[model samples]
Target: DAMVIQNPRYQVTQFGKPVTLSCSQTLNHNVMYWYQQKSSQAPKLLFHYYDKDFNNEADTPDNFQSRRPNTSFCFLDIRSPGLGDAAMYLCATSRGGTGLTSSYEQYFGPGTRLTVT
Candidate 1:
C-alpha cells in the first residue's frame, strides 16, 4: 500500500528560531504539497512541487521554505518562526500514478503539530 510518513509527530521551537520538518513517501508520486493550519481555519497551502518545480501561494510567508531531495522525500524549513507560525504542518503526495481514477487524489501523511514557544 502507498504511505506517507512524517517524523517527530510533535515539534517545539523557540520564537525567531529555525526549525525543519520532514516528510517522506513510498508512493513514488511526482507532486507534493505542504499546508499549514491554525485553530479551526482551513489548511493553507504554503508550497507545491511538481517534479522539483515549486509554486507558492501569494500569501505564503518568506520564512517558509521547502526542499525535495528526491521523488520520495520532502522537507519544510521554517526560518525564524514567530508565535503566529505555530500550527499543524501537513504533507501530501499525489499524481503521476497509473490509474486515472485516483490520479487527482492526494495521499496525506499524519500532520506534524508545531508549537512555538
Candidate 2:
C-alpha cells in the first residue's frame, strides 16, 4: 500500500550535534507536513509543503528546519540537538491543500524517535 515511511525509527545524538529525520511517501500527495510530539503533549505543527511552496507555523522555532528535495521526500533538520529537543518526529501527507472544500485528512508514518544525550 502507498504510505508514508520514516527512516531509522530510533535515533540518538550527542548534545549540540546535528540530526536529520526523513520521510517519504508513495501516495504522490501534493502536501506534506512535519510535526513534533513530546510525551503526552499535543503534536505541534512545525511546517508543511504545498507543492513547492513552504509554509512554517508561527510558533515553530528557528531550530527546526525542513527540506523537500522533491515531491515524494522531505527532510527535517535540527541544527543542534538538545535534551529538550528529544521527541517523536512525525511526517504526514495529505491529498488536498488547506481549503474548505479540500479534504483535511492526513496519513502519517510511524515516526522517528530522537534522543539527545
Top-lDDT candidate index:
2
Q: Candidate 1: minimum summed lDDT over ten consecutive residues — where?
A: 95-104
Global lDDT scores for all candidate models? 0.91, 0.94
Mark the regions of model 2 whose C-alpha exceeds 4 Å error after superposition. Answer: 98-101
**Candidate 2: pairs in clash:** none
Models, CA RMSD each: 2.0, 1.5
After superposition, the stretches of candidate 1 with alpha carbons farther than 4 Å from their true spots are 96-102
- 1-117 in candidate 1: lDDT tens per residue? 779999879999999989999999998888999999899999889998998899899999999999998999999999999999999999998875466544868888999999999
At residue 12, candidate 2 shows an lDDT of: 96
Best candidate according to TM-score: 2
True-vs-predicted CA distance for residue 76, candidate 2, Å: 0.1
- C-alpha TM-score for every candidate: 0.92, 0.94
